[model samples]
Target: MVAGGGMGPDDEGISFAHALATLKEQGSALLVVGSVPEELFAKASRTMLGDPDADPPRRRLVVTPEPNPESAVRRLRETGPLSAEYARVISRGERARSAAVADSFDEMTPRTHVVDDSIRGLGTTIADVIEEFDLFAGGLEPAEFRMAFDCLPTVLATHGREVAFRFLHVVIAQARSVSGLVHFRLPRAVDSEAVGLFEPLFDATVELQVDGDDLHQRWHFRDRDITSDWLPVGDRP
Candidate 1:
């Protein structure tokens, strides 16, 4: 898991996705918590999927709480990934039904899915988010899928600890059910007391700090067999 403190919000998602892309060897699913801007999250998505030439077709899902899902898709188009042709966008944000963002990917434009107004959309409440997650998780086949949550601090701050804890517990269970890897990027600005509730839940944790143009990272693990130290942002594990 990656925790963003002094590190820029954009870097938090980008770095997390960069790491996950390098480490993922199987199908994956991403659950973005909207802690970072839509543009940065899109970059992270592009990074996580990698370039078409080096990527194999894998089951993948990109879920977000943005009002305009196209905002995420457009940033992805800018990444120049040839595989963008395979993407489809689903808009569930009730504030806007259509993705008004301009696209440069031509035929690679993403298709949209809209939920009826009768139902709640993303970010309306913690329960709504959990229900949406369950719907997404249920559609996945029984296989390995890497799951990343951009920033969980938003959840805890929005609904309180109990709700966020239940949400994480459900998400972790969903990931473990298929033996998928789960990583969450949480903002360090949150109360350390509140953040403490999540540290023990992860098998490993990473602390991210930004210094000028450089990023420093430290890793902690439950086993403590691996030695880790502050490393350059782009350095691979």
Candidate 2:
């Protein structure tokens, strides 16, 4: 059975806040799989990171293959406060390295770590950075940390399924060890075969769809073998 059965929906559908709270209460690290439009994903990421002003502030890490760290920071800031210690950005690849260096002048921007793809593979670089972040926390509880890996498709495209699978295996173990909530975004529609290939790595899979101005999501819990009804993405509580 799922650890938190009370989170199951009624006839009316589930609220965004209730779903998030249940996930946190599940007491183990979660690997949530999902893909959505970029804008909606960003909003969901912000929600998952929690309110900056909320109690027991969380440490956030964003790993992106995008070239512009500034643009990422700007998008994050659109939702809530982003402090240097509260959040860190890992800019991956050659282009990102250049962009991160150029954007280093702003103290207000989240600290960016540039990982050059030429020197190290994506899996190694991500693992190393996550280790460093963990070490830097120095005894902070794992639940205090959250990570958003924004480029699974890019990783798969660059390294192929076998390599991406190996990378995810290691990274998911890392997240579970720390008891952190970490999510990887695919950003595009994938066939069932592909989903089946990656489904075992995650605790839950969230499928998202857009219809006109309404955004909806459905959740699947692997361990309990339960799938949620499609619920509208509402404002964060």
Candidate 3:
């Protein structure tokens, strides 16, 4: 079931903060589909990770395709301070591509797990890494963990739609089992048609766009046939 919060429709629109709070409170899988700036993507990632100072303190996992380990760490640092124990990264296929990436992972606080792109093995490796994080949480509630799958388009292209779908199905199931909030990023520019194919796998889908200098986002919640108006993405409440 979808997590409930003060996200009900109002005369204006669904409050972005309220919508996000709902997802964070309960474990849910979300798909973010759009073509927007990298900075905006970072903002959405930060939102999924939630406040670092939260009472229970959320653990974060970022699955990225970035080949440069330093660059990936930098981007994550932009989200907030990195706690080696609470934050982790699954560097997909980057370890084999660069020696530097492999060595860097060994020396990072937000420990990194490097895995190859084999379609058959990728899902297992990711699930294993998440399980490691879950164990580290010491049997805390699922809401204590958050994950960001930052390379949906790359995975789709590398494994094809059918294979990618299967992989996502497994990952989403893992998320639900642990009640962890997980989100996959899909840039519509890569394959717009793929959105519909994958939307059913997620509890909700967030559509983002840019209009001149402003950025806006609309959320389509699956459990409830509710869609929020395009509201400007602003500072977190």
Q: Please, what are the lDDT tens digits per residue for candidate 2 over residues 121-145?
A: 5566656656665676674464566
How much lDDT does each candidate structure score?
0.45, 0.65, 0.71
Please identify which of the two predictions, 1 or 3, would achieve the higher TM-score against the true structure.
3
If scored against the real structure, what TM-score would every candidate get?
0.55, 0.79, 0.81
Candidate 1 has its poorest 10 consecutive residues by lDDT at 117-126
What tens-digit string does per-residue lDDT give for candidate 1 at 1-237?
A: 334455655666566555444334332233322234444434444544334333333223334445565554564354333242233343444553544244333456544444432212322332333334445446433332333354365456666788777667766665555545445666553235655677656655555555565555555543333324565444322
Model 1, global lDDT = 0.45
TM-score of 1: 0.55
lDDT tens digits, residue span 74-110, model 3: 5456555466667767776654356544455554445
Best candidate, TM-score: 3
Select the stronger candidate by TM-score from 2 and 3.
3
- The 10-residue segment of model 3 with minimum total lDDT is 1-10
Order candidates by TM-score, high to low.
3, 2, 1
